[model samples]
Target: MKKPMRLSTVAFFMILAGVAALGVAWWTQHKLGIMPCELCLWERWPWRVLIVLGVMVPVLPARVGRGVLWLCAPVLLVAEGLAICHVGVEWKWWPSPFPACHAAHVVGRTLAERWASMPLMPSKPCDAPTYLIPGLPVSMAVMGGVFACVVFVTLCVGMVRSKKIRRF
Candidate 1:
């Protein structure tokens, strides 16, 4: 295959790896019926962006696509940082800023009205330790870290390969 085509294939695999990771998270949640906290949703933003970049790199212009791939570095870094912090909070290594993951439960006689007044809440805490892989020492956040590292490595490799191919 041509260099661009090969690079595109690698990009597709990177995105698929991300999707598979998320899928495992979702499947774990489904089987266990666990929900993500508000902060957890926030943790997803970077991965979501990576997923988009993975899809776009193959289809978009080279310059724009390269820029997007480069952009993923910092994004994943921050997200990984947030996930690490979140895991720390869950492990009691630190206190989470958002003490409440889900919305506060309604109280008072007007419970129905209170419920009605409750604001729309996110799926999970941005720092909630919801990863329950039996016998495993790692949480979802840790797994996210692993994925980010893999993606960064893959992106770097792709960049190098593309540069070499361009020169040839």
Candidate 2:
């Protein structure tokens, strides 16, 4: 007979996945000197939440832990939605919803005045796709979206398939 998937095992892997995703995002920004755009920064929140919530899932009773993990699907969906919005913006299909993503126009006749009008913090245009690898066609946002979809579907399938397990 085939073995059933364990909620605790999935939950443990989930915690690791969240950590790895967040770590890569942070490492790229701090170590690689790649500044995250506003939407990019916003994308990290769901992963952070996942890490926080997934930490206790392994210790909880099976049903309760599965319930908690099930709740994570909606969170992942939210992340997927954000990634889609970003992808649309990057593709010029629609403008970014965040006002900060728009570039500030330097409205001054003098060079010094225009210089003074520049934003204190540098910001990237949300429409530009950020590719991690050189010459790679896929964007980071698209990759994240794909990852979210895979995880969301996996969790849903796992939960539905293993319906009778009682312990964590």
**Highest lDDT, which number?**
2
Q: How high is each candidate's TM-score?
A: 0.74, 0.87
Q: Compose the digit string of candidate 1's lDDT tens values, residues 88-156.
A: 877778766775664466655787887776656534655456546678878877777777777777777
Please give the CA lDDT of all the candidate structures. 0.70, 0.85
Error of 2 at 153 (Å): 1.8
Cα RMSD for candidate 2?
Answer: 2.9
Question: What digit string (tens of lDDT, one per residue) describes model 2 on residues 94-156?
Answer: 999998899987879999999999999889888888888898899989998998888788778
Candidate 1 lDDT score at position 1: 55
Give candidate 1 regions above 4 Å deviation. 1-5, 102-106, 109-128, 165-168
